[model samples]
Target: MGAEAILEKIRQNAEEEAAALRRQGEERAAAAAEKIRAEAAADAEALLESARRSAEELSRREDLMTGLEARKNALAARRAVVDEAFSEAHRMLLALPAERWEALISRLVLEASETGEEVLEVPASDREKYENGLLERLNAALERSGRKGKLTLAGAPGKMEGGFRLVGPVYDVDCSFEMLLSLVREENEREIARLLYPETRAAGE
Candidate 1:
């Protein structure tokens, strides 16, 4: 062969080899770019999932807090209603006529006189009633009930709304309206609640 022909053949072979190497390098670079893209997509999906879970958790917590706050407000409203009912009862009792109050006081005195020798401590406002022969009436009622006790009015008036305190030599008896209501409040509260909030009671049941 001629020298020019041999040189041309060698150049052609080198160009073919270079072209193959370039093709291989392009293929490797394309595979690497695809791998990087797949990894990036996976990382993005994971971040999105984490954010979704965090958002759901936060929403659940907010719902729970809202429910708790609503319950607290409902309980406070119920308490206010119960307190108002008791206050109304007190007002009604205090609004009774003088004759009715006297009769009530007479009955209370008769019921309270234990040994018939206790001192009746009434409110300062009620001193006049005792002075007006109410004590005599109370004694007669006590005698009828077979209690051999005499009731005398105390010199020091009690600080009370209504009803009297029977002061005995041994122990004193509190028969004031406030004290009586306090003694029965726990039992009365259930009845009052049932009446005031029948829906709540039915829902609970």
Candidate 2:
């Protein structure tokens, strides 16, 4: 396929991946949240019942302690759901087929290229992939877009497990899958937490 067509495929794949992530996160959260809610409610009831049998001061302390612990455990469980979603995303990205993988990294490289002449630093495992024709296609895309179009693939393998980096004279850009996914998680963490425990969020608000 042509450079533009590859880029378009990359965009479509990105949209699909994002949608899949949202669905996986929502499904996991929905599944785990209900179980946690019921368990927490039951535990709270049992704690309250036991507290009632204690002296007034002791009952108050017990209630406070148990409530704090319950909140801590609930928060932990919710965080786990968010963690699993990203883990699945990482898995899916790594598991992509060769064509899709080429499309993705190509798109990322094109976007990250500031001058279109930066050296492409790919994972050591993928050197042959880029050397084969990836760099030429990227340069073609860059030139077509009115950039320098002098991009070259690095001989040494990069440190990133997945994704590539653009090494420019002034600065470098990291487009590693790890950093990208972390950025996604950082931006949507609160929103994901709320989704997992909407009732708690609503009560707080």
Model number with the top TM-score: 2
lDDT of each structure?
0.54, 0.58
TM-scores, each model vs. reference: 0.57, 0.61
Q: By summed lDDT, which 10 consecutive residues of candidate 2 come out lowest?
A: 1-10
| Maximum-lDDT candidate | 2
Residue 205 CA displacement from its true place in model 1, Å: 3.7
Regions of candidate 2 where Cα sits further than 4 Å from its true position: 1-72, 195-200
Candidate 1 stretches greater than 4 Å from native: 1-67, 189-204
Candidate 2 scores a C-alpha RMSD against the true structure in Å of 15.2
Q: Encode model 2's per-residue lDDT on 98-137: one tens digit a residue.
A: 9988878777776666678788888988888777888788
